[model samples]
Target: MLRFDDLQLFVRTAETGSLSAAARLLEISPAVASAALKRLEVQLDVRLFARSTRSLRLTAQGELFLEYARLALQNLEDGRQLLAGSKAGISGLLQLSAPSDFGRNTLLPWLDEFQQAHPQLHLRLLLGDRVSDLFREPVDIALRYGAPEDSSLVALPVAASNRRVLCAAPEYLARHGQPQSLSDLARHNCLLYMLGGRVHERWRFFDGKRELSQSVSGDRLSDDADVVRRWAVAGVGLVYKSWLDVAGDVRAGRLKVLLPEWRGEPTPLNLICAHRAQLSTPVNLLREFVQARCAELLAHAPWNA
Candidate 1:
């Protein structure tokens, strides 16, 4: 005899850590959420939460009930989706996040095509270099580069890209002379990308059967990939950049690839989502579209030559 609405309110409150936050997600008044919890507790004849002036903590009984509630709601949602099946066209607001450069250069064009295909779906994209917190943010999906550390979330590997190529403008290479070996890199000005707390100044190369790592220095450093690309094109310094970002420039003769024989291991691109049994039709559609595009890009990577 538990109400579905009451159960939803309770689950939202537990997930959000407060009734006020749950109300905001549900688009209801806090008082209404509080009343629903009160009624649910009364009906169950159990104290669900131990409330203090500052915070609300779930009781032992509440914790046990929450697990069941989460599973039941997920099952119900799955059932609804199953019933809808492929007949259900994507139609809902989807929030997404991705790294700035890749999102603009890669995802933006594909998204335009996707929106045209699914006119009913509304999409909101947030672009930044920093990773987004899926639990705290109202995001449906996130596109992440490299590997993900969170084992709790579901990650789908969509595409693969190479680490970076050390390159420079023809004029710069002509004046400075191209580095013939890893040891020679020390003689040339190197542009570095800062990752985490470490500056990625070490260049790794594959020489037929062996791998080499060399430490290099530069007068310029940046966390932004686009800025690094511009600097390299302006003949400021040699830059290490993703093949996808620099491929067009290299093809157009604006930039030249320094080491054609030596290449690094491929980096992975992933589509991440919250670990849940039920995902909306709209989210699934977008994920599929992205996966398809990723495959296309991987097949035609400029560095494959």
Candidate 2:
């Protein structure tokens, strides 16, 4: 078996073509470099170098071993760096995009805690309602609702059980009356949000064998989803939004879930990346952290009752 230091000395000696030169490069004495090469040759039972008074040269055996030696050293280096990174704690830039509402209210504070845990990590966040192009945009990851339409992208689920919820503030419910059934939504004002230049006017509900779908129109629409949530909280209109986005508001009694029996569409939250390779240690830790938060929110949801 080859010892690690011996292998390294052999490769350096072969590259430099002189034992003294390799020794100086490696910050070791020439005598030590000479002894290491001799020990290696004895182990292999092959004279790896031809020495003359004028010059040192590799024997035929040495030439063949050099390639394998270089590969082994490189692989060893890669493993060392990987272990070092793990030991050093997560460090480096984590650039991610998230929806306007969730980013502002939920992810922002969560990331603050995450950054505190790994102070070496630098975070760059972009918040919006528009779907960022992972390939075209300068974002390493994106937090999005619903599974990606592209089969090529890797969608790491943060909350598979999360769904859209139809909600309104107490004031709105008081003034317009709570919708008792799907048909009643037609008479009440619905707050709409737009993405990719089109308004999401369609609200869907699935209860047992019945699927109630409606094309809702409201007195207001906004390109920013957070603004739509704000409108709902202000009792401007009813809003259909992700449970995660509205969980805090519902918990605070700022919004009330309408039509609890008529379950809204499944809009599972996911961490989107261009591919599986994009899942680095920091990204994975972030996913685990966010997933835990989602689970906590779900556990307290009144709709579960």
Candidate 3:
């Protein structure tokens, strides 16, 4: 007889690629995870994993067994969903990942309201600028900006933000006169945000029928968007920032939008989740709530107007 607990541990370990990672996802010790796998292998009378100092690999038998284990776990989840649907109450820990600035300024407040509405649900929110691997991480859902390239996850569009504004403070603009054309940007100091091992210094602008790219240079760069925004507000240099982050400052006349008419492409925000055959009641409820909240907040935003 195979224990479901052992089966779940096996599936998680295979999905995450390490016993320690699986244990972290399951909120257990690595030793316990190793013991569970050992017991599972003993029950089946076959070695499941070929382990080394740096990596773990599945044996031929382990690969075949994993398929059946995934099916069994998914079936159990489907059964739980059916039972929960009849009761109409969502109860479980919902793990979420989102960017630091958006999570703090936008998503967290909405989550507070959601928690108040669903008192029984437990929510864990992880905030970071770097993208987390959903398959490896323990996150149940992620709020992602820009289009994700991973086809394994199910991405549902929740909201979208317009082209980011390239702006600086009035003081900075006074010192380094407004750029007359895209080529003129090379002369001015620009604050860049680094991502994917490159600093995004090229600003794209549109002039009705034609598009142009401006190559700008900056001595200061940071991965954190909030720090970049603060530097721009302090009159250090020009920055291309999202409206969601600088809308308040722009409205208050602290930060000014440069080349407002020549904006770049818009970015869509998505709620990405693992492509499981069945979703638990808690996951389904939180997904719906987040979708609604995102739509509401983006609709009434005053910056674009």
Candidate 4:
């Protein structure tokens, strides 16, 4: 394989038009530079220089190879600069995965602000409810609800106190009457969402003393959580989702919190990744940005108020 140092020396020699001057510029002996040039010529089986005592000049073959050698050196320099910038936390592209509803309704805005703040940074977002395989997928990180079910992955808490809320539109409540208790949910049409190919018909809540899990059914089900939220807004049925996902609707009175006394079990938001090494500068910055924004948003949520 051709060495980069050889390419650098060849380009420098061509620019200086003197083997001794190029060697001096590169902080090497003239003899070493001469030997290196000879090795390069022998490797390619071509005479690179028409030598004279006055000064060296590039031969026909040398001129052709000089351009290619300069290009190779320039590309290597560019790569080195990129690595240097990365070390200083300057620029990078972060590939991320997030749940569909939260990714769209919550994270999309946050991402916009984060991107605007760092113009050199780029982002690739995979929005869906399906659990992404961090090891297999090209994603560098993921925004997930609850603790990671995969014990091997590292989960960093982004929102330590985020919780789901069960809500319904005022129009739907007026038609079917409000559900006063967990048992009352059975009589109501509960909208279901899909996550990782399974219907999320089972709802879990905390009643101050213990955890409660209830199985619910509805006339409609959707793989997209945002669709389920929209159905609730349209007064099709009840929706249980992250308070962050429907905070705007609740504040707008498009949906009302059901059973305010009982809160759903806290499903802490986490930044998930296959390994700790994946938490590079851009990924870590994004994690901190999202965490701070989530805290601010949840604090001002209508349900929290």
Output the lDDT of residue 5, model 4: 74
For residues 45-164, what per-residue lDDT tens digits would candidate 3 score against the true structure?
A: 999999999999788999888768866876786686567755345556777898776787667878898888777678889898777777656566788777677787788776666456
| Model 4: colliding residue pairs | none
Give all candidates' CA lDDT scores.
0.76, 0.84, 0.76, 0.83
For candidate 2, lDDT tens digit of each residue in 76-96?
654544776673477766779
In angstroms, give how far residue 3 of model 2 lies from its true place.
30
In candidate 2, which residue pairs get closer than 3 Å at backbone N, Cα or C atoms, i.e. clash? none
Look at candidate 1 and give me any clashing residue pairs. Answer: none
Q: Which scores higher on TM-score, 1 or 2?
A: 1
For model 2, the run of ten residues with the poorest summed lDDT: 73-82
RMSD of every candidate to native, in Å, equals 4.1, 14.0, 3.5, 15.1
Model 1 accuracy (lDDT, Cα): 0.76
Winner by TM-score:
3
What TM-score against the true fold does each predicted structure earn? 0.74, 0.72, 0.80, 0.70
RMSD of 2: 14.0
In candidate 3, how many Å is residue 228 off? 2.1
